[model samples]
Target: MAARAGIASSSTTLSPRVAQGGSNIRGEQRGKKRKSPCLSMPLFRSPLSRMLVSPRIQLPGIRLRSPLVGHRKSPYAERRMLHIDLNMEVEEENADAEERGLDSGIDQVHQENAQNCFDADDDVPVALEDEETGVDPGQENIQPWFDPFFDSDVDDVVPVPQENTRKNVVPDNDKRRAIFDAMLVKARKGYLKGHESKEVSAQFSVPVRTVQRIWKKGKSCLDQGIPVDVESGRSRCGRKKMVVDVSRLEDSSILSRTTIQDVATQLGVSTSKVYRMKKEGAIKRVSSSFDPHLTDQNKIDRLRWCLEMLDPRSVPHNPVFKPLFDYIFIDEKWFNITRKTVRYYVAPTAARCIRTIQNKNFIPKIMILTALARPRFDSDGNCTFDGKIGCFPFVTHTAAKRSSVNRPAGTIEMKPIESITKEVIRNVMIEKVLPAVRAKWPREDAGKPIYIQQDNARPHIAPDDRMFCEAAKQDGFNIKLVCQPANSPDLNVLDLGFFNSIQSIQYKSASTTTEELVAAVDRAFEDYPVRRSNKIFLSLHACMREIIEVLGGNSYDLPHIKKGVLERQGLLPLQLRCNAKSVNAAILSLRTMADT
Candidate 1:
C-alpha cells in the first residue's frame, strides 16, 4: 500500500486461483535457487518496484548479481541492453571528467560553450578541460597570459612601417641607428595599453612569447623612468683566438726559416698570420744580388783603390773629394737583338705576338764599347759639353757569301763580330775611343791628365801597351790608362748604372737583326739624357763613399740625390762631397791590411 500527497493506493488480497498459480511458479524456482523475500513480492509489485526489478547496468568498480535465467528469454531484454549501453556512456563521461580535473559543473560549462556564439572580439577557448579541477588536460601548472580582447583606446595606433625601420637599421654607431631605435621604441610602446603582447607581436612581426618578455623588460624600465632600449646582442660573444708572439720573428730560431709557410709551421700559426706580419712591416722583402766573390787580397786592392780617390790635401780637415772631371769611363757590353721575354698590352680581341729566336742565350748581339766623361756645366748650370764621347759597335762589313731573300750575293752587309779578342779591344780604343775623346775633349782640358778607367777584362790591353801609349801621346794630351780594382764593377762609371739605362731604352724597340741591334744600342747611348750621365758621375762618388763605409764590400743601395733640382738651382757640383768619416774609415781599413 502507498499513501502520498499525489497518490492513493488500496491493496486487495488476490483470489485463491491466481495466488495459487504464482505460488506454484515461485515454488518451482525455489526448488532450484535460494528463496528470497524480494522474489516472493513479484505478485504485489508496484510500478517503481517493477522498474527496480528490471536489469540494472554494471559500472566500473561495482558488483551485480546475474538475473534469473527465465528473464534471458523475456521480451524486455532488448530494452535492458539499451539501458546498459547508456549507463556505460555516462560512466565513461564521469571518468573523463575526473581525468581532466573538472568539477560537477563541467557539464554545464560544456553546454554553455557549445550554445554560446563568439563575437568578433571574444576570447576563443583553445582546448577542453577537466570538470572537477577546472584545468585543461595535460596543462596542470602553466598559467600563460591570455589577453584576447587587448582592451585599449589606442587600438588605432599605427605601427611603424617595416620599410622605414629596416632602412635605418645599420650597425650601432651609424647615424641611422637613431631612427631605427626610435621606430622600435614607438612600435613596442604602442602595446603599453594593457600590456597587449600579442598585438605588439603581430605589429612588429615577432613571436608572441618574445613580445611578452620584451614588454615585461620595457615596463620595468618605464617604472624606473629610464628610456626603453633593445640590445642587439651580448658584446664580444665571438670565437676566441690564440694570439702568437710576433717578436720571435727576429729570433735566430725563426730567422733560420726562409719561407713564410715554413716559419708559420714552426710557430704553429697560419700562413696568413705570417703574411700579416710581413704586411705590418715586421719583416722585409729584398732581392740579394751578391757581390763578386773576392779574396782577401782583392779586398785590400779594392780598399787601396778607394783610398786613392780621396783628396789627401783635404784629409785631417773638412775632407773634399776630387772632381775627376777628366776621367773617361769605358766598358764593353753585348746588346741583344731582342729580349727573351717581353710583356705587352693589346686589345682584348687582338692576336698575341708570336716571336721566335733560334736560341735565347745565343740571340743576335754585338759588343758595344761605350765611353763617357764627367759632364761639364757652366756657372749658370748650362751644359757646356755632355760626357757622351761615342758608343761604337764591334761590327764589320763583309760580302754575303751566298744569296738569300734579304740580300743578294756579294752584297756588303754590316754584321756583328762574335769573338772580340784583345786585338779588337785595342783597335777600338786606339781608333774609335781615342779619336772621339780627342775630338770631344773640352778645349780647356786639352792638356790635362785624362785617365781612361777600364775594368779588368782579359780582352782589355794593358795600360802600358805601346799602341795605347803612342795613341795617348798625340794631340799634346797627357791621357793615361788605369785599371779599376779586379772584380769591382761598382768602381766603373759605365758599369755602375749607365749600361743598364742604355739597355732599358734599347729594349723598348723590337730589333730582329744584329745590325738593327747595333743601331738601336747606338741610338740608346745617344738618347741617354746628359743630365743622367752627370747623375751617374755623382753616383760613382757616392759608390766610392759606400765602399769606404763597408770596408770595400759592395753591399749598399745606390744613394739618390735630386740632381735635376740641384742643377736647376745652379747648385749641382761636379763632384759629390764625400763623408769624412767614410774617408777615415777607408784609410783605417787599408792600414790594417795584412802584409801577405
Candidate 2:
C-alpha cells in the first residue's frame, strides 16, 4: 500500500495481496448495504477472483500487468480508463436487470463471463479483468462478422459501413437460394476466415446473424450426412392457392355459372379467389348467343341462300359478293319508352335518379320498321344519296275519347297499332316506305332492280304477293321483295348491329309515351351515319362468308376488318370479297344434302 505507482508490483506473477485481498474486501462489502440494481453485477470482478463485487466501488487509479495482451502498456492510468468503461456497462446492465426481473440467482447470470477473465490472468492483480472480459451491457448485435470492414489495399484503412442495419430486408426465394449457395461454397471450403457469413451478408445486404443462422442450419444437415440446403421450400412457405376443376363449368345448367358467386359456390372456392382466377385469365365471362338447332333441310336452305348471294360474274375467278347497293335491308323493331337501366351524372349531394310509370308492363312501346340502302358515293368520294329510306311507325292517328292530363277530349292522338297483321305491314310499306324510297333514291340508281330484302316473319308479305307486286311496280320502280332464311336474323344488317346501335342512342333519353318513343327511335334511325351503314353492309358480307364456312351454321363470331380505317383511307370497297373455296364448299354441301 505504501508503494508509489511505478513501485507497485508489475510482474506477471500473483502478488501476496491477490488471493487474500479480494476475500477481505468482500467480507467488508458484505457488511455494507447494496441497492437492488447491484444484484445484476458480477460477484467477483478481480483479474483473478471468480466472485462479483458491486461496480459502485470505484478504484480511481488501479493498474496491473498480465501475460495475455502483452502489447498494451502495463500502466495503472490506462487500466483506470478501462475500469470506468466497465462501471458504465454495469450500470446499464443494472438498468436492464430491473427491466428483465432477475428471478434467478445473480451468480447464475455471470459465472461463465467471470470465469473466462481469470483463466487468462490467474496471477494478475485485481484491476485488469474488464480489459479481457469485454463486458458490454445488453449488447444485442454482437456477433462474428458483424462489423464488416471492406479492406481494399494493404495500406488502405478498411471502411466500416452501416450496411446491414437497415430493417425490412425481405428477399424473395430466388435471392435467398443464391445466398445459400454462396454460403455452402464458403462453408465447404473450411470457413477459414470465420467471417464467411458476414462477407456473404455484405454481398447480399442481409443481417450478419441471419446469415450465421442460415449457415448453422446447413451445417447441421451436413453433420447428419444429408445434402446441405439452407434455402426454404420455395412455394411451400405461405397458405396454398386453391386449385379449380374446369369440368364444373361445362354443365348445361345455368346455376353452375350464372354469376361469380354461382361459379364459386359450384367450384367450392371463395368468391374473391374465383374473381382472382378470372383476373389472371384462368376463366372468362361470355354471353352465349347460341345457334338455332338446324335440321338438314334448314341447313340446305341457309347454304343455298348464302350461295345465291355471291355474284355470278366473280364466282369461279374471284367470288365476290353482290354490292347490295340496290338491296334495301328492312327490319321491324319494338322500341320501348325507356331503358331498364340508365346512367346520369348528378351532384354528389343529390339523391339517386328515380323514375315512375303507371304500370311497368303497360309502358309505352311501339313497333317501327326501318328501311336502309347502301349510300352511293361518286368517284370523288362525295355522297350522292344518304341511304336512309324511311323509318315508319305502325300507329294510326285517332281522336282521344276521354280527356287526360296530357290531352283534352277529341284531340287527335297517335296510338300504337294493336294487331300487326300482314295487311298492316303491306299498307305501311306501300303508303310510307315506297314513297320515301322514291323521294330519296339516287337518280342514277332509279329504275334498277332494287331488291327489298326482309326477314321471313309470319306477318311479312311474300316475294310474289300480288298486292305488294302491284304496289311496287306503280311508280316506274322495279322494287322486288326477297325473304331471307327463316330464323336467320344475322343475315340482315339491321339485326346484326344497326338496331342495337339505334337502341343504344334511343335509350339515352327518357320517352314515356308511344309518340315520344316513336319519335326517339325515328331520330336515332335518321341520325345514323351513312358511312357506318356501308360498314354494316361490309359486315353483312363478312357474316355471309362466315355462314358459308360454317355450312350455314351461325356458331361463328362476326368479323370486323377495321372498315372505318379503310373507308377513311378511301379504300372502302362497294362489296366484300368471299373465299372461292368457301363458295365451292357451300355448293358441295347443298349437293350432298340433295343426294341424301
State the C-alpha lDDT per candidate: 0.65, 0.69
**lDDT per residue as tens, model 1, 379-490:** 6668899888999889899999999999899999998788989999998899989999999998887988899999889999999999899988898988899999999998
lDDT value for candidate 2? 0.69
Residue pairs with clashing backbones, model 1: 100-130, 101-132, 101-133, 102-130, 102-131, 102-132, 102-133, 103-131, 103-132
> Candidate 1 — which residues are off by over 4 angstroms?
1-267, 560-573, 594-596
Per-model root-mean-square deviation over C-alphas: 24.7, 14.9
- Where is model 2 poorest over a 10-residue stretch in terms of lDDT? 143-152
lDDT of 2 by residue, 1-596 (tens): 22322221122232112221222222443224321111112223232221222233212123333234333332322332112233344446445545544323233323433443234646432223332333233322222111011111223434234343459666676777688778877765545255877789999988877677776776688779997666656557688876888677787486568898988888889999888999999999888756668777777788788888899999876999988778898999988887656678899899997787777777678888999888877888778887888888899999999999988999998899978999999999888888888888877767888899998889998899898888888668889999888778888889988999999989876786777788788888888887777788888889888989999887788876888888788787888888888788788877988998
